[model samples]
Target chain A: MDLTVKIRNKTLPNPVGVASGTFGYGEEYAQLTDLSALGALYTKALTVEPRPGNALPRLVETPAGMINSIGLANVGVERFLTEKIPYLETLTCPVILNVAGSTEEEYASVISRVDSQNAIWAYEVNISCPNVKHGGMAFGTDPVQVERLTKTLRKLTDKAIIMKLTPNVTDIALIAQAAEAGGADAISCINTVMGMVVDINSRKPAIPAISGGLSGPAIRPVGVAAVWRVSRVVTIPVIGLGGILTWEDAVQYLLAGADAIQIGTGNFVTPDASVKVLNGIISYMKEAGFQKIEDFHGHF
Target chain B: MKNFGSSILNQKEIAIGYREMTISWPQSLEAPLPGQFLTVKVTENPAPLLRRPFALSGFDREKNTASLIYQLRGPATRLMATLEINSSIEVLSPLGNNFTLPEKDETPLLVAGGIGLGPVLYLARELDKNGFSPRLVVGGRTESFLPDLSNLKNGSIHYCSDDGSAGFRGTAVDYLKSLDWKELPSARLYSCGPQGMLNACHNLALEKNIPSEVSMEQMMACGVGACMGCAIEVIGPEQYARVCKEGPVFDSRRIKWT
Candidate 1:
């Protein structure tokens, strides 16, 4: 009956968390759904300076997914402390601050500035955002840079550090191991699969960025397989995401060796997706005679 | 905004590619205003995973009904067109900011291009109901692309087409330019349309020394402010604003028009 997920010193009330970027600092969904019922809330990416983001046509719909090139558009860390943290403090669930920057110093600076905030429960290191030209996936694609950044940030705060990985890389298990070796409490994958859609009439890329990170049901299989591979390589808990819309889709991640699951693009499909998935998970566990989230894992 | 369970009361194609769908609204929720919008879950199937956003074309408080005008330009709308009447659907209602009303002495000029007719028409009707004289100019590629105008009798309505197959011989902005400025000396413009049309309207508003508001359209994911997608650059320190949150309606002067 224990749905709690423990990573190092922090324990999530349940195994369901809303993905970063989709949840927008927990305040945006406060009016739409119950924030206290969530296991965790991953915030939009916060950078060193406020980002203007990409140009027009930042989003485009595919068959069962969407490509987003938001380029980490955020209010920066200073404003995060002044403007966003007050609202986040009111939420009952754990707040995982999803951090991103264009350089190692920028990443460290952001973490150092907000590391003192009591509301922020953990840091979801975002080294996998594919929309930005520099830093994001650059630090994530290589194991050396991943370990170096993780090791450096690990020293800044005692809070749980979860390295979010991108699916665009070849051999994601290696990247997971790198995060583990550098003192990460856990790792989450996959950030988003790189994809593109062309406007045939205009004869140009659908999004102004030309290519964006694809997330939705279309990338669920890729996410599950990546979790399966990465979970085997690292001892850290694997937080699975990418295209989880229903409880059934979430159960697929739990069965695929993910310790917990995050609803990414699904949050857009329905605001109450996390609560629905959580309720469904409890019912599924009762029906299967499984007492804990771990029971759904390691069967394969 | 609250998510409401609504059922289709009526669905009909009023134009070659445009369809008007009326749904039973919940009395418990606030009635949707002219510029506010709703996102509909077209199907339970995940193929068109994201809910499509549509502006409130009409809302009848007495009957508890709200209507939307959608174009069959994509898979979502095409699927929406196939939905059976009285079938239940999930909708997130009354989202985003609305257009501000003009002063007592100011004339309201509402312009629409193609599918953008939904909110503009609604604004014109609402303005008429409020005893304000409003002028509506709707433009499209041709007459076939325009919606049925018989029901829109509350205010003055004009039509224009690129091919000169309808009312005016040019675009909506061009039609506005041809009008005598002295008659509409104290006019405020409101528009929703293709980006080019919106830009032209913004330019025309600047040239005439009139204030204007524009309803913007962007491909949205989370129709709420959660996703930073659907961002439109604006003249501000923040540099960007979400179409689903800060607008779908904005002051024409605030937009960092390209």
Candidate 2:
């Protein structure tokens, strides 16, 4: 009946977390739903400097998904420590600071600046964002660069480090192994899949950037498969995410070997999506006679 | 803002392509003001994955009800059209900033086009109830494209059609230009419509030195402003502001019209 998930020295209260960038610094959704119900609250991506992000028409709807090119719009690390931390400190759930940058030095500097805050529970290294022109998918696609960045950031903080991986690679397991080799505590797999939608009359891309990261129920299979592949290659816990809209979708990831699951695009669909997911998972475990989160893994 | 479920009290088609849906509003929640919006989870189906946002067209404080006027366009709205009365739906409401009231000395000139008539009508009605003589000019492709306005009273309502089949023979901006500025020297503009009409209104306001505000539309996700998906370019250091957060309503001067 226990739902606690442990990653290295840290312990997540449950297995359900709202994905980074989906939950904005814990302040936006505070009025809508209960925050303490989450096992972890992953903040929006924090970079070395504030980003204005992409231009207008940043989002467009597809059949069962939406494409976005937000380009890591954030208030930067200094604002994260000063403006965001005061509110994050009031939350009961573990706050995983999602860090992203264009270079290794920028990533290291961000971690060094905010690493001292006790309110931050862990660091979710974002190396797989597809919307950016630099650093994001570039560092993620190459295993050598992934290993180097992970190792460098590992030395900066004693907190748990979760390497987020992109699905737009030839062999995702290889990248997971590189992260494990570089001393990552855990790995969150399958960032948004690269996708595009075109306007037939205008003969132009629906979004201004021409291409964006596709998320929602459409990318669920890709994420589950990525979790299955990456979980087999790396010994560390695999936190699965992508198009988890319901609790049943989360169970699919747990059965596929994801130690924990994150609700990303589903948050926009239902504000209390994570809470529903967590409650559903608990009911499922009880009905299946499973005691802990690991019991839902490897049963397939 | 709060996320709660409400039963559909009524749903009826008021025009060829548009329908007005009235739902029971919770008395505990603050009453929605003009230009403020709500996002509706259209269906449990995954095809329309995200909630669709709509502005509050009308609110009956005595009855504890709020209504939205939506066009029967796209898969989400098309699905919404099929919803029967008494059907339960999830709603996240009173989101974004509301339209600010004009100064007592200023005349409110409200303009609407196409499906944008909802908030403008709401604003005009609220202004009228508050003892201001608001002038509402509605424009569409033809008379059929506009919603039925027989229920809206206490305000001066003008209708314009492209083919001159309704009231005036031009766009809403054309009607605005046709007004004698010297008569209503303190006229302030508030508009919601197509980009072309909004831009034209912005230009007219600039030319006449009239203060103006506009309701902007963009494809949105997480209407609570978490996703930063509904971005509108503006003249500022930040460059972009979320249409769902900073506005669905903003001063006309703030927008960087192309």
Candidate 3:
């Protein structure tokens, strides 16, 4: 089994990547985990401008999941390039910049800027942002839009472009196909699924934002299923996500045909979750008659 | 995530049957400030996908222990109240930002309600250790529901109960009317607790022109800033900031509390 994978022509030491949003810029939780151990790091979604985010009670616990609508509050692009990007350059793994935009112009602006700088390993295009009332059901929902965005980036820069898809879409396979046709080098399936949690007593929403994206273990099955379904449809590799907590869980995605796995909600509960998951994968491989982590990718 | 299986540290009942647990983890306790919090993995089996967020009441750097206070509110926190000491817990900590304390020689005033006293106590001690003594004003619904956090520090403690069960009856707010506002003419106010209490403190601080900072408690996913899970509106100015990131602590005036 070979756990190593090459995406956008870049070689990853392993098949595990820390899911975006869970590990905020990675700089916030450095003391809690070994940042270098993970195969790669995905930053929090960076919008074209600085945002203050939504209002209070942004989180609500469901029976087996969590709902959030962070409204993509970020330090904007300029601040990220100067302050965050420089710090990101020091990390051992390549940093995948998760870019969100309301318009193609904004997206193009972010790409050209980040592309100009050589710090980032690749660009992770976010099409699943639910909090914003955007240009349509978001750029990723419509397959044509996804293809156009991918093709646009394909023309803009030589860096590997990974289109992040929202699970709420009607057909993830169609979306993935469109991305591939548009020249996307890879696809990371299942950005947060849209969700809402209301306070029964107050008859109001829990989050300051009326609604938010759902993440954590409850969404794992949904995410993995999408990855499996889409991986079967697209020739390009898939970076699986949604509720990945341990190494054993990550291996399931590999067996389901994911070239890589992103640990999202786990980072919130345990910062070193990526390290633990990676180690667990290595140990499981040795015990399960597998030689490498990559060998398990798509065996199912 | 290091789950110790069953080594629960300290559990004590406060306010009805609600109990608070202080768990031990090997992780460093560096980032958390006075008002910041942590997300503790609840349940021997996690029924909830997210860990419950708790205020970092205090921590022992020498022992690598993080203390959390909570009432037995639901199925999850109820599970947390049932842990035994020495049980190893899987946790992520030093999680959020802390409250800002007054400089040395300044007398601080801390206002708290129910379990809200947790973070304020840590702030009080941080101030005390640095040679500034803060006056403690605590409140609760009834004497029985009040917590017995008697060991926090040697600061002058004032108590108020809604049902007249203890101290100056009729709410912590009522006692405020009788205090010598001039004696502490130049004081920085620190507060935590229920929203009504916080609002009252905010109003009073503004009326008195006293500088104030507050700890905002909200249900959160990722006690860090990423999930956008714990943002509170800084009311008057109309901006939303994460209770976990921009703060578990905000200058009282900055909070857009309606």
Candidate 4:
């Protein structure tokens, strides 16, 4: 079975990749698994300025998932290009830089700085950061804003641009269509369902940010539904993510019409979760007498 | 840092609800620093999902044995307390940064609160091996809650209890405030305990202008840096640093105690 996937002119060796924010530049996991075995690596959210992030009590475990209000803390663009990119360049797989900003110009500026790097194959524009107060969901929830930001970014970088959409919207398909119209190369759906946990004893929110993005097994169905709905309206490749823990979970996203899958919270539980998911997909394909991911793409 | 599946060498309760578990690990697993920790997989099941992180209390270089002292506070720890001898547990170890050691002429003053003694006790032992006699102040809710410190050689321990069931009639912080800096000049302070205790010690250290280090605790998902889960804010510059990565240990001045 073949596993190659094309996003613009770039060809991913497989359909599995580690999600942004969950994997820290893909440098830490190299010791646990072979970096070349997976399809792609999406780094953490990159802002124009170094972010200190949010206050304490940033993480809390729930029923079958986790909530985080990390607030996009990162080394910023300058240090990322200097200190981090050298290690990321050594890997054989494609690296997609996940960029976030508090403003449209901030996004454009970060994209402009990274557009020349050979190590980065694509740019995942993050318009849906729930932890921050502005610029993230503000730009993502509205279809017009989504189109405008993508259009502006499309003019700046020659690299493939993938619009990451938030799941908190009333209608996700409309937003996906807007991104496609704005000249986006692909679309990655469902950047964490917005949710929060309360500490009953303290009578306060579990996270200091009061609310956070929920990711893990509990949100799998929501992610599949969003991907299924968005893929129906957009012609661009849909990268599905959210609550993917096992090989079976990855297959569900593919059957729902996601051309590729990104593993997020699963990496925290098991360091080599993406590799395991990739192997599981290949095994299932062989068993079902199917050859390549295309045979089962959107089969549902 | 490395992840190893180490077998339980022996385990027994040292306090009312605390257990001291020693696990036999491969020789390749390097010695963990005093303030470093390990993320433990309490059970074979994934229900709890995240591994429970514990401070490295002790280790034996020749025997290739490492030890962890933890209290039965949550479901994960409850399950961890019931593990039989010889049962193998997955341990991701030598994580986070360690406490900075003081100079030969500087005095080491170690403070611990309740089960927070985990790292403090280890630091005391380490200082002892280096020919420095550290002064350890241990406090708990009651005498029964305090772990035995007889095994900590080459150091002096002052026990304090809330109900005056042990050495002093007040908290560790109160005991710290009672000390006269004039008598013990150039003493470097190292502390780990409840947030209240750590905060009190931080303020006292600031007032006395004694260089201090604190080991902070928070709920963590991945013991590694990837999750960005265990976050704490710093003073002056005011930014967040992951407790799992930047530290479970930091300069007392770096932490915004509030």
Give the Å error, residue B119, model 4: 1.0
Full ranking by lDDT: 2, 1, 4, 3
Where is model 4 chain B poorest over a 10-residue stretch in terms of lDDT?
A: B41-50
Q: Name the regions of candidate 1 deviating beyond 4 angstroms.
A: B151-154, B163-165
True contacts kept of each: 0.88, 0.85, 0.72, 0.51
Q: TM-score: which candidate is best?
A: 2
Summarize candidate 2's per-residue lDDT along B127-182 as a digit string, tens digits. Answer: 99898889999999898887778644556889899999889999989988998889
Give the Å error, residue A132, model 2: 0.9
Which residue pairs collide in model 2, if any?
Answer: none
Give candidate 4's iRMS in Å, 1 decimal. 1.7
Q: What are the per-residue Cα lDDT tens digits for candidate 2 across A1-300?
A: 789999989789999999988889878999887899999999999999999998778988888999989999999877777898999999999999999999999999999999888899999999999998884799999999999999999999999999999999999999999999999999998899999999999999887799999999999999999999998888899999989999999999999999999999999999999889999999999999999989987766
Q: Mind giving the per-residue lDDT tens digits that candidate 1 earns over A175-257?
A: 99999999999999999999999999999998889999999999999999999999899988899998899999999999999
What's the distance in Å from true for residue A115, model 3?
Answer: 0.5
Please state the Cα-based DockQ of model 3 relative to the true two-chain complex: 0.55
Task: Write down the lDDT of every candidate, Cα atoms only.
Answer: 0.91, 0.92, 0.77, 0.87
lDDT of 3 by residue, A202-227 (tens): 89776657777777788888988998
lDDT of 2: 0.92
**Chain A structural similarity (TM-score) per candidate?**
0.99, 0.99, 0.95, 0.98
Better of 3 and 4 by TM-score: 4
TM-score of 2: 0.99
**Residue A103 lDDT in model 1?**
92
What TM-score should be assigned to candidate 4?
0.94
